[model samples]
Target: MISTGEEVLHGDITDTNAAWLSRLFFEQGYALSRRTTVGDQLDGLAREIEHCSLTADIVVVNGGLGPTSDDLTAQAAAMAANTGLELSEHWVAEMEAKYARMGREMPETNLKQALLPQGAEILDNPVGTACGFVMRINRAIVLFTPGVPSEFKIMVQDQVLPYLKALFPSVVSQVCQRLYTFGLSESGISQTLSSLVVPEGVVIGYRSALPFIEVKVFAPQNCPNVSAFYRTIIEMLGDNVVGIGQPMLSEISGLLQENAMTVSVIEEFTGGALVNELHRDEACASLLKDGRFARDFAKTDKDLASLAEAHRRETNADVVLVVGGKRHEAVSVALAGKGAVWVQQVASKRQYSQSSYRTVIATLALDMLRRYLCGMPVFGHYESLSSLSSFSNERRTG
Candidate 1:
């Protein structure tokens, strides 16, 4: 694949299209031999396309398909294919009709979009004037697409993917599942699962996305027992497993909606990050009622319990969650509802930036609330279980 853009090369814009296409192709069992990104210069673009075409069975070139002067992908495609450019009358008429439907005359510069490599097939772009084209170079089939994300995505989904599937009938179907976990380092999680027996036709991989580790399980479409591997990892990882394919806050939102419960937020050290996360979830508009920011509070369990109860009573919510403690020392979470209160305080395992620390505190508070609501075991150094108990909140050294 060849990505052509000066913005990407100069760091003016991120190359998200390359990442998206890579994942899309990989999930469909396509072997991406190499990905090459080039500037808008015609020489570099043509050179990369020519080289990739000779080395790989399939080549996809994105960007440089605009109507601007720097748009040279069409010409470069012809150069790579060892042919001359030909004006596609069908595309020209289509562009004219499209502009007429929009009550505007077709720009003369847009006529450049109708040019294609000789004997190339036009890939229709329904959303834009820049047309995509497919042609063969050496042993590889090269596809050229526009740089605009909307147009590029539409062309790939509507035309390029279908063509590749039809052209390569032997490509197998693969299913990729992601399981998210927290409170465990990526290396630790990997070591924990290192001894497990991997099933046939299944491939497991791990990636760390800060505060969470994702385990991606890839299996053949016909494999019915893929879920068993996921369950085994969950059991082995224990409480570290948050949920599958979602963040911790999202999982908490699902649980709240499923159990028909509402919650109020009271955070101290985490700033309003927790409240912001709750508001981010659409269902939280109904589930989250009142959020309070307690900048200063006594470090006693009695004070935390009182704060939680007062927040619950003021907001009339089924549950109230609290986050407190000194920065860089430790954080405490308290869940009060259903005639009980549970408080757990955990220290920072590693030094993190203030933003990351706030995120960790927010997720920890949400996980605590989830466990309390679901009757799952809560992980903490100190645990207090009582119908009406007061918490003595203090950071303890291990």
Candidate 2:
């Protein structure tokens, strides 16, 4: 793949198109062999296209297809293929019709978009003005696409992928399974699963994305022991496992709806991030009775428990969650329910940025509620955090 434009080459804009394409192709059993970035210079773009054509069976060229003066991909493609540019009268009419629908006249400069290399096949772009095209350069088939993410993605799905599948019929698809876990460091997760043996042609990998660690397994679709191997790893990890191919927030939301429970939240150290994360799920949002930012409350576990209970009574919710702490000190999470109150306090084992610290606290608070809902222990052990104190109380009735 050759990504073109000064913005992408100079890092002025993120190349999300490349990342999206890589994932898309991998999932379709066609992994990209190489990726290259070139500026808007015609000679450089032509050179890169010619270079990739010799090594790859297929090459995708992105960007430099707009109507502006900087758009030079069409010329570069023509140079690489040793052909002259020819105007596509059909695309010119399509552009004119599109502008007429919008109640405006098409600009003269837009005619440049209709210009294509000789003997190239036009790839229609339904969402934007920049049209895509396909041409052959030496041994490789080069496909050109616009830089707009929406248009590029749609064209790849509707046009490029089908063409590739027909071109390469014998490619075998691989199966991938993902497990999401929180409160465990990447090294700790690796050490815990180090003794397990994986079958041949199966690969296990770990990726740390902030407060959660993702474990991914890749194997052939016909692997017989993959399911059992996956279950064993989950059992070894125990309560740290939150979901499969889903985040904790989604898991918590499902539990809340299944149990028909409503909740109110009060936060301090994490600001309003706890509420924001909960509101992201529609089911959770509907069940959330109240969400507030509280700063004047006492930081003690007993006081936090009392505050949560009071809020629960005020909102008449099934549960109330409260978080409070001083910066760079121990943080506390309290859960108040109908007949019991639970609180846990922990301190960070290493220094973290303010945003990261807040994110950890917020995730910890959510995990506590999730555990209680699942009928498990509310306090969890984390490698980067140490428990300071815990409290639990069951109310009595006469």
Candidate 3:
């Protein structure tokens, strides 16, 4: 894959297109072997495209397909294929019709977008003005796409992927299983799973996406024992395995809805992030009885437990969760229910930025609620955090 643009090269904009394409192709059994980035210079872009075409069976060129001066991907592709650009009257008419519908006149610069390499196949862009095209350069088929993410993604799904599938009919699709876990470091997860022997033609990969780690198993669709291997990994990880094929937040939200339980939350130090995450899911949002952000709250477990119980009673919710802590100090999470209150106190083992620290606290608080909902031990253990204290008390009812 060749990613072209000065913005991407200078880190002015993130190349999310590359990440998306990499994952998409991997799932389709055509994992990208290499990624190259070039600036807006036509010569550099052409050289990279030519180099990639020789090595890769298919080369995807992203960016530099706009109508502006720096939008040189189409020209670079024509240069790399040793062909001149040809105007596509069909696309020009389409653009003029589209602009007419919008009650505007098409600009002359937009004609640049209608130009294509000689003998190239047009990939229609339904969302935007910049159309994609495919051309052959030496031993490889090269596909060029616009820089805009929405248009690029749509073309890939509607055109490029279908073309690739038809071109490579016999390629086997890969099988993948993703497991989400929190409270464990990537290295720790790797070491913990090291003893498990994977079957031939299957590989385990780990991605640490902060606050949570995603473990993936990639195998050929025909690979044997994949399901058993996945089950064994989940069992080994135990409760730390927050979810399979989803994140902990989504999993917890589903569980809440399944149990027909409503919850009230009171939080400090984490702002309203905990509540906001829960509310992101429409079903879970409906189950949230009350959400309050406390600017000042006592960090003691007793006080937190009391606050949670009071909130639960006030809102008449099935459960209440409380989070409070001082910056750079210990944090406490409390869960109150009909019969009991569970409280856990923890301190970070290493210093983290304020945002990261808040995320950690919020995750801990949510994990506590998950454990309570699942009937597991609420005082969970984490490798990166030290457990200060954990205790349970009977709820006082009047």
Instruction: Choose the strongest candidate by lDDT.
Output: 2
lDDT of 2 by residue, 336-395 (tens): 887788888889998988789889889998988898888888777787888888878853
Compose the digit string of candidate 3's lDDT tens values, residues 213-314: 999999889787898999999998988999888888789888998899998888887889888888888887899999998866764678888888888889
Query: What are the lDDT scores of the predictions, listed in order?
Result: 0.81, 0.89, 0.88
On a 0 to 100 scale, what is the lDDT of residue 182 in model 2?
88
Candidate with maximal TM-score: 3
Clashes of each: 2, 0, 0
Tell how far residue 166 is off in model 2, in angstroms. Answer: 1.3
- Model 2: CA > 4 A from native: 394-398
Extract clashing residue pairs from model 1. 301-391, 301-393
- Arrange candidates by lDDT, highest first: which order? 2, 3, 1
* TM-score per candidate: 0.91, 0.95, 0.97
* TM-score between model 3 and native: 0.97
Residue 131 of candidate 1: its Cα lDDT?
90
